[model samples]
Target: MPLGTLDRDPPPFFRQGPSALSKLAVCSALAFFLMVADARFKVMQPLRVVLATVLYPAQWLAMRPVLVFQHASQYFSSLTAAQTAQQEVLRKHSLQSQRANQVEQLSLENERLRKALGLRERLQSPSVAAQVIYDAADPYSRKVIIDKGMADKIALGSPVLDESGVLGQVTRVYPLVSEVTLITDRDHAIPVLNTRTGARGVAFGDVSLHVDAMELRFMAANADVAEGDLLTTSGVDGVYPPGLPVARIEKIERRVDAVFARIYCVPLAMVAGAGHVLVLEPTNAQIPARPAADVPAVVPRRGASR
Candidate 1:
């Protein structure tokens, strides 16, 4: 009775014609031939298109199950993720709507302020919205290039700004793009004033950090400058608008040996972190036209090198 089960014959296993390795080899050879023929002979074009079209739906359908399962697992894994995603979308929409509203309000307010201050009507600086393409390729340089350029009405010396405050001015203009110099460059200096005390000073920058923080040079040792003082544009440079935020006095260092107090200032505007910027094209009234007499004329001198 026990031997009866063992006595039953095993079911016949189906035998494939070729071994798996052999079949794989044959398939690889055929694929190579097809690729060579299509690339070299320009044949199999129609066949490739036909095969792709036929298999596309099947391939997509097969992937749907895996993708659906993965998404379903993710959805169930964490409620915070779903909430975060929803919050992100809502925040984005809210910001965009707020920005739109602000644009309208600014336009109306700018018009009224311009009229009230007798500021010349800006000729509408023809501008194109541009995105910051990338940071400066040279780590030592604090500069950036924007997608917009001369082709888009961007010009040298055109002031760039963000919603918060002034960023920088365009230094170079190319056909398809433009380069901007950040206020953080070692050579780039801004005339700033202590907003609270109305004390004025020039802020100098260090190019290494690529931020607008600068040292207040030549401030007297007995100067009333202190930490937390808000620095703003004094309008002496004529490049930046008066009262525009520049930086904050973060710290002050004074010693008997040093002639001036070493003060570090942090820029109010985050130029590096901004995605979009506004280009302010100076109006005729904003910048006074230089008279021919006042403009320096070059005169050829006999002693000068040719």
Candidate 2:
């Protein structure tokens, strides 16, 4: 027989325990008794407390990295949320500001239109209403373009006006638009009458001041002109209507050696950024020619010199 088939047993002298089944039964009974004793008499309570106290430091140390990672994640999340909220608030504030500005601009525009309409109605002139298209291309001259042109009966030398006074006169007329020369242009002049002292003078546009101003040229240095005086069209020029507003006396300067007073006036009309205006028919156009019998002599034409 093989050696593996023989019984493997310890010598009696060396044997010191019972069979495996008996040993298992004895261990189970001792475990059950210990459990009962712990439950009823609290025998292991002190040992458990001592073990927890001893292991607390190790437990805290083992969880340190997890706690740190959780806290970091929460901090980053909170920062991101705050930034997003701030951006949203800024966007809303900007939108409101733009809306408020638009509303204010619209209100001002509407007020101007209303005043212009009232002025137009009060004047009994044959006029055509037109809107400003844009400013003229000339940088050195104060001029603007209107939407009306020859097609709309806008003629040369026609007076244009805004709410307050004569803004300008139509200078160039195209098929669909017309160019207006403002009263502030250097080449423009208007005959004005002072309402206070009943004085007549010619107001020429002044470019030397670099401001939108006009000067009463050729007036005596000690003239009766005063500040705050109102100037209106004298109706003698056969262009602007009588009693129409032109400008107001803003400043007057009299020099010892000068022959004329350096009087500056501010135009009553909205010369800059005018939206709506009126184009009036030229006053000379409406006047009839003199009778042929009243002519002193009929001058021969230059081409008839042959």
Candidate 3:
């Protein structure tokens, strides 16, 4: 009985449906028809849109981590670049500020030097240009030290002048430097003539009374001196050249009890702040020598008395 059941075909309940070749042929034909319909009439367009809309939330959720990582990296990179740019701008600003200060200082020094050269061209006497090194150590006297001395052929008693007018006279000479007593020094005196009235007087430094002034010691109370009157060297002292400006009459006090009028004069030159000066040769050196007179004949004229 077991041999007969094994050889017979199975019942309909256990029979296989379609063969593999037949199912494959049917699925290929259906896919080809669907592709042709979609190409000719867009038959699946609505279905595709519905499917994409349904899957959109799932696609977005899957990409969230990748998008967050890209955004964070970009933010950090931009922040670091901004900080570097700010530091570069600050460094450039500091460098520009230092260059501007150097330019300003150079401009001022150039101006002062130009003015000093101009003064040298206007003088008539043989002169040597010198820079004021410093103020004299003696506080009681108004004096300054020049860079030039005997080595520069600077002679004692030479008149010194600045751009404005007479500044001082060289009193002492050294190897590398010389000392000039300013016109406003207590020990200095100058013979000045009034340009307006041609009045001649001796002007002495008024250090005891004022800082940078001169005094007309013994002028008459009714003298022609007045305020704003210009005074120049009279050339009688044999030190300074004639016609050089010295000072201006600032104040004149006349009193009945006092015999002399107190005249205060302000010097024209920048006595304390002069940076460059001109040292002029003494007037005596420039003056021509006088010729010797011819000796009188040994034999006197017959008409002359014995």
lDDT of each: 0.75, 0.91, 0.90
Candidate 1 residue-wise lDDT, 85-181, digit = tens:
9999999999999999999977865654443233223324433446688987988778888888878877677766655555677888999988888
C-alpha lDDT of candidate 2 relative to the true structure? 0.91
Per-residue lDDT for 76 in model 1? 82
Candidates ranked by TM-score, best first? 2, 3, 1
Cα deviation of 157 in candidate 3 (Å)? 0.2
Q: How many backbone clashes does candidate 1 have?
A: 0
In terms of lDDT, the poorest run of 10 residues in model 3 is: 108-117
Give the clashing residue pairs of candidate 3, or none: none
Q: Name the candidate, 2 or 3, with the larger lDDT value.
A: 2
Alpha-carbon lDDT of model 1 = 0.75
After superposing candidate 3, which stretches have Cα over 4 Å from the reference?
Answer: 1-116, 290-306
Per-candidate Cα RMSD to the true structure, in Å, reads 26.2, 7.0, 8.1
lDDT of 3 by residue, 132-227 (tens): 999999989999999999999999899999877899999999999999999999889999989999989988999656788899778999888889
Q: Positional deviation of 259 in candidate 2, in angstroms?
A: 4.1
> What does candidate 2's lDDT look like per residue over 144-232, in tens digits?
99999989988899999988899989999999999999999999999999999999999988877757888888899989999999999
Please tell me which model should have the higher TM-score, number 2 or number 3.
2
